[model samples]
Target: MRLRGVKGSRNIEDRRRSGGGRGRAAGGIGGVGLIVVLAIGLFTGVDVTSLLEGADAPQTQSGQVSAQDEQAAQFTSSVLATTEQVWTKIFNEQLDRQYNPPVLVLYSGVTQSPCGGASGATGPFYCPADKKAYLDTSFFTTMSRQLGASGDFAAAYVIAHEVAHHVQNELGILPKVDQARRASSQNEANALTVRLELMADCLSGVWARNVQGLLERGDLEEALNAARMIGDDHLQRQAGRVPNPHTFTHGTSAQRARWFDTGYETGNVGRCDTFAAARL
Candidate 1:
C-alpha cells in the first residue's frame, strides 16, 4: 500500500469535474428496470450494454476538481499503472500474447460511455465495447461506510477485478460468454456470468501474487474482506432478501474467497482457469 511517488497512468479520463446531465433510462425503460440493471451491476460485474443500447446521454459541463478528488484520481491511476505492468509481463510470459491495457474513466455521479451512461449507482464496470473501465470514486466511500470493506487494498482489488475483465475480453472469453448468454436460458446465462465473475476474482488474486512487493501487512485481508462483502449471497442477505443459489449471478462468499486464495496460493495463470474446473 506504499504508493508515494508512484507514477500515475496518463490513460485516465477524469470526468469528476464535469456536471453529468440526468437523462432517462436507455431504451426508454422505466425506473424499475434501470434499478434492476444497476443493482445487478453493483456486485455482479454483469454487462448491461444490451440494456443500455441506443441510449442518449446529456452533455456535461466542465467544473473544478477539489484536492480530495485529485488524490483519489492519482491513487486510481497508480493502481491502473501497476495492473498494466503486471499484466503486460503476464501476457508475454504466460500466453505469448501482447497485453493491451484499458482506459480507466474516473467520473462522478454520471458520465457518458460507449457501453452506456455510467453512474455511481452502478459501481465500477468494464465496458468491452469501448475497452474502458468506468469508476466512481464515491464508491470507495460507500465500500467503507456501507459495505465495511475499508482500506486502499480493498479499493485496489475493485479496480484490479475490473481490469481482469479486460483481460478476459482480450482472451476472447467475454464475447463467447455473451454469445452463449444470448442463446441460453436466463438461469444458464446467470451461471456463466457467475463463472466469469469468479474468474475475475481469481485473476485479481493472481495480480496480487505478482505484486507482492507492493503489498503490506493486512493488505490481503482487506481484499479478501472486500470480496466476501460483495458476494451475491452476502449482498442478498444485506438487502433482506433470501439468498437463492438459482438466482445468483456472482458466486457465494466462500466461493469468491476460495477462488481468490487459489490464485494467490498457486500464483500461476494456469491455476486461475475457472472454466476447466468441474467445481468452482
Candidate 2:
C-alpha cells in the first residue's frame, strides 16, 4: 500500500477525458436492479458479454475528471507498473521467457472491447482477443462503499487478478481452457471457470508476495478480505440468495482466500497450478 514513490506505468491508455457514454439500463433492468447486477459481475470478475451483447451503443460524451477519479487513476497506474516489474522478473527467472506486458485501458462508464462491450456492469475484465486489461476506476469506489472491500491494496489485488488473466493467456493456459470450456457442459464449463478464476487469485497473491517490501501493515489482510468478499458464495449471500455450488463461477470465500494465501506463502508459479490440483 506504500506506492507513494512508485512510478506509474507508461502502458496506460487513459480515456477518462473522453467519456465512454452514460450507461442505460439493459433488458428493462434499471436503477438499483441494474446496479446489483453490475456489482455481482464486478465482484465475480465474470465476463458479462451476454449481459451486453444486444445493448445499444453508448453515446460518447465529454466531461471533467474529478480529483478523486484522478487519484484512483494514478494509483492504478502505480500498481500496474509494480506488476510489470514483478512479472518481468518472474518470467525471466522462472519461465525463461520474455514478458510482454498488457496495456491497461482506463475508461469511464462504458467502453468497447473485442470481447464485448464493457460498462460498469462488466466490471474490470481482460479481453483475451486484445490482450489488454480494461478498468473503470469507479469500481474501486464501489468496492469500498458497497462491497465492504476497501484499502488501496485491495484495489491493487483486483488489478493484479485481471492482469493475472493476461499471464494465463501468455502461458497458453487461457486458449486451452477456452477450448475445453467450449466442448464442456454448462456445469463442467463453470467448474473450469472457477479453477481459472481461483488460479488468477493465486497469481495475484504471487505478485503481492513479490512486492512484500512495499506492503504496509494489514495490506495482506486487506487483500485477503477483498478476495473473501468477492467470492461467489459471499456475493450470493449479499444478494439475498442462497449459495449454490453448481452455479459458482468463482470459488467459495474460503477457497478464494486459501488459494491467494497459497501463492503468497509459496511465491511460486508452480504452486498456483489450480488446474492440476485434485482439490481447489
Candidate 3:
C-alpha cells in the first residue's frame, strides 16, 4: 500500500507509552494456543475475555517507544483515516445514512477496554461495548514472524476488518446476532460467529475496493494470504490439532478468501450477506 500522502486519523487514542506494560505470560493458553486464540480474535468483534483471563495483571510501566513503533503508529493512523473516508462515503451513497467511525485505540502490550483487559496476546479486536477497536501494533510483527502474513496491505486488511465489525454494529446486525447466538447451541453459535466474521472479511474487501488507487501489485494477495493464514482450520493445524468444523468460529480459509473476493469484485455491500447464503 502506498500511503505517503494519506492523512492520519484524528480519532486515534494512542496509549503506547501510557505506562501500561505487557501482561504476565499466558498462563494456561500456552504459547501456541495463545497464537491460535490471537488468530481467531484478529479483526473479530467477539469478546475474548474468557480466553484472555489467564493473563496476569498488567505491569505499571513500559519501555521507551522505539522509532519503529512510532512508524507503525503512523501507518495505522493513515490506514484508519482511509477507512473512515471510504466507509463514510459508502454509507452516504449506499445506505443513505451518516457513518459514525469508531475510535481506534493504539496500545502497546496491554490496555483496559470496556469489554475487558487486553494484552498483545489478545490480538486486535473491536469491543462493541465501547465501539472502539483495540490494537497492539506489535501484532504486525507477530503476524509476519510467526504467522507468515506480512506486507503493508496485509496490515491494512487487519485494520479494515476490525472497522468492518464496527460497520456491522452501525448496521444493527451485531446485537441481533448476539441475541441469536445466546439462544443457539454451541455448534449453532459457532456457525453464527463464522458468518459474522466472514462478513467482516468481505466488508474489509469493500474498503479495499474503494481505496484501489493506493493499492499496489500483490497487495490483494497479501490480504488473501493473511485471511487464509488465520482461518480456524489453518490455525488448528498450526496448533497441531485436527481441523474440526464444529469448533470453527471463523469460516474456512477458502470461504474467507472467496467472500473477500466477492466484495472486492462487486464493491457492493449487499453482496456481503453471509447470513442469507445457504452455502459458505
- Compare the candidates by lDDT and give the number of the best one: 3
Model 3 C-alpha lDDT per residue in residues 72-162, reported as the tens digit of each score: 8899999999999999999999999999999999987767765666667667878777788888887787777667789999999999998
Q: Model 2 over residues 87-205: C-alpha lDDT tens digits?
A: 99999999999999999999887676666566665668787777888888877877776677889899999999988988988999888888787799978977888888889989999
> 1 or 3, which is superior by lDDT?
3
Q: For model 1, where is the 10-residue window of minimal lDDT?
A: 29-38
Show pairs that collide, candidate 1.
none
Backbone clashes in model 3, listed as residue pairs: none
The local lDDT score (0 to 100) that residue 133 gets in candidate 2 is: 85
Tell me the spans in candidate 1 whose CA falls farther than 4 Å from its real position: 21-62
The regions of model 3 sitting more than 4 angstroms off are 25-63
Please list the C-alpha lDDT of all candidates, in the order they appear. Answer: 0.75, 0.79, 0.80
* C-alpha lDDT (0 to 100) for residue 252 of candidate 3: 82
Per-model TM-score versus the true fold: 0.87, 0.88, 0.88
